[model samples]
Target: MPPRSAPTARQRRLGAELRKLRDSVGLSSTEAALRLKITQSRLSAIEGGRYGVSAERVRAFARLYDCRDAALVDALAGMTAPRRRNWWEEYRELLPAGLLDLAELEHHARTIRTAQVTHLPGLLQTVDYARTIFRQTIPELPPPMVEYRTSHRIKRQQVFWAHPPKPYSATIHEAALRMRFGGRQITREQLAHIVTMSERDHVTVRVIPFEAGSFPGAGQTVLYAEGTVPQLDTVQLDTEHGSEQLHSNAQLDKYRTFLDRFEAIALTPSASRGFINQILKAL
Candidate 1:
């Protein structure tokens, strides 16, 4: 088997910061590379998130860019530094790049808020529910692939319940509640699971009712994760082609607004729990 690819979230973040700094300084990669005494190709690699740059090199680049804040430079240096291997590494070969990226982001996130229109959020999905969803994919994935995907998803859910658990809030649409992924029994279990999860101090689940009608989401799901440091939140969206990360202030604001609007239309926690119980009893 081939060696697994490295998780690109950290590298991608470093690349983004480098580009931002360069742009802020009005220097192209070639200009920056000339000043840093490195070849344009190497600088391009760093800015493109394909290569890892050393902390010293990062500081030097910050200095060359005339970035005045020592703390900001130090934070970038820390972010660019190598991270210890995480258990998710073991499943790299079995999971999609997008899923792996999401898991890594979750591992580092101080808080995660998600809005889903058609399905339960992965962090809140039961094993059986995940398996059913995977098996229903259009291309008809092989049984082994389905099993692997399901297991990978379940493993990702561990972050929500890990020691010193991270905060998670999911706003799900009422449409998702009506769609039975596995069967009546599995749907019942899934709803019960949601009730149990909502009991956690750090977990909040809200439901957007069908009657709410035409909210900001408009058939999209988004995840906004707060990083270890402020100003490092990441917004992720799922598309038909793949996943896209949004980091710019405008993009992040757009999603944040969307989430806020969705929340406005969503049932409050107490009402959501009541709806969930109703579903469970009906099932």
Candidate 2:
């Protein structure tokens, strides 16, 4: 098959797992390709996410690598299955590629956790709030591009409306709750929506008040998407340029610790609800 010019995060992750398996087993590319009856170039293409891996190939790699985790192998095979075009594809030309990839990742997430220091989480932002945030972009954006991004962000919240909703945990700092984006009314509505969302059994919203005291990594926004297995988990960070994804075991571990620390200092769901109410009252 011809190689893809651009691969999604899911595709790259499958390829990374394949390479990880080979590395864990201490097999050189040439040696593994010879054992699997394939060329080194093809293996490299698959590992680099330039080639689409077939289900058969995924299993073959599992068998050759001496991996006996039936669940992990099945999960990998599922990734190899033909994928339908997601909603994000509709705006592929309008939004940044990283933003599109983020939408796709959120669509497939089983469990989502996030920590926000300033801006509200994208998945929970209201339309007006999102538009205001977009308008505030440094150097400013063209009206059309701002509209496109605002619409794209609003649509991303649909994950909460899935047939069987995925579990979502958000740790929002007190400062973000008081930002007043789009003025007091818009920010109030956004906070209300967050409160309503938290009432669901699958959703939890916690507040990290200024009174929480000191903590590490307080200046970052983190969205952790948990996959079927821990090995497939991903951590995404928003930057001035674009989205950055982290999947290496070390990177994942570090972010996991960040979430743990922040979550520890956050208010419980009930308290968080009351906290939002207090903020709304002040507004």
Candidate 3:
């Protein structure tokens, strides 16, 4: 296949890992290419994610690198396999690349865990909640753009709302539920939606009330997307700018611990539902 002008974030991540393995063995690009019996430019392209690598080739690279972890190798090889076009692809041109990348990550996650402070988790927001948030975008988005963002966000939720949904856990703050994004009615509806979703078989929604006191990463949001195996786990964070994806062992470890701490201070699923219900009643 011809080289893609812009490879997806996941694809670049796969290539980056391969390059790290080669570096760990103290091999120069030329030497690694020579060992793999591929041209130097070909090696560069593969490492840059401009070219696709096969599962067989990934295994061969692991062997040459003397990587002893079978599980890690298997996970890496899985990344090399071709994937089907997901629903996110349809909005490739309409939305930001980060949004598409997020959707793709969630599509393959074995389990999903997230926490949001001021805003509800994108994967859990209702149509009105999502539209209200997008409608307030900086510089004021055009009507078409707002609808595009709303549409893409709703589609992302399909992973949980679809048949045989993936295991999901969302830790939200009381302030987020009471923010009144579209007004009292909308916020009440959003909270009610969260209550409904929490009752789903594969979903768990926990809330951190103001009474819980302070917590780590005070205002930041976190989305931990577990891969088929531990080695492929990812942590996606929402920032003042666009979203950021973290794949390193250290970053994932830190965020996982952070989330664990956050959840510890949060209300239990049952109590959280009651808290939301009370808030909805007042609204």
lDDT score, candidate 3, position 126: 88
lDDT of 2 by residue, 165-192 (tens): 8899999999999998888789889999
Candidates' C-alpha lDDT: 0.83, 0.90, 0.89
Off by over 4 Å in 3: none
List residue ranges in candidate 1 displaced over 4 A: 1-7, 69-72
lDDT string, candidate 1, 178-264, tens digits: 899888999999989999999899899999888887878567889998875555779988787767787887887788888888888
Which candidate, 1 or 2, has the higher TM-score? 2
Candidate 1, number of clashes: 0
Model 2 CA deviation exceeding 4 Å by range: none
Tens digit of per-residue lDDT, candidate 3, span 125-228: 98989999998888789999999999999988889865678999999988888788988888877888888989998999999999888988868889999997
In candidate 1, how many Å is residue 259 off? 0.6
lDDT: the better of candidates 1 and 2: 2
Residue clash pairs of candidate 2 = none
Candidate 1 global TM-score:
0.92
Clashes of each: 0, 0, 0
Instruction: Please report the TM-score between candidate 3 and the true structure.
Output: 0.96
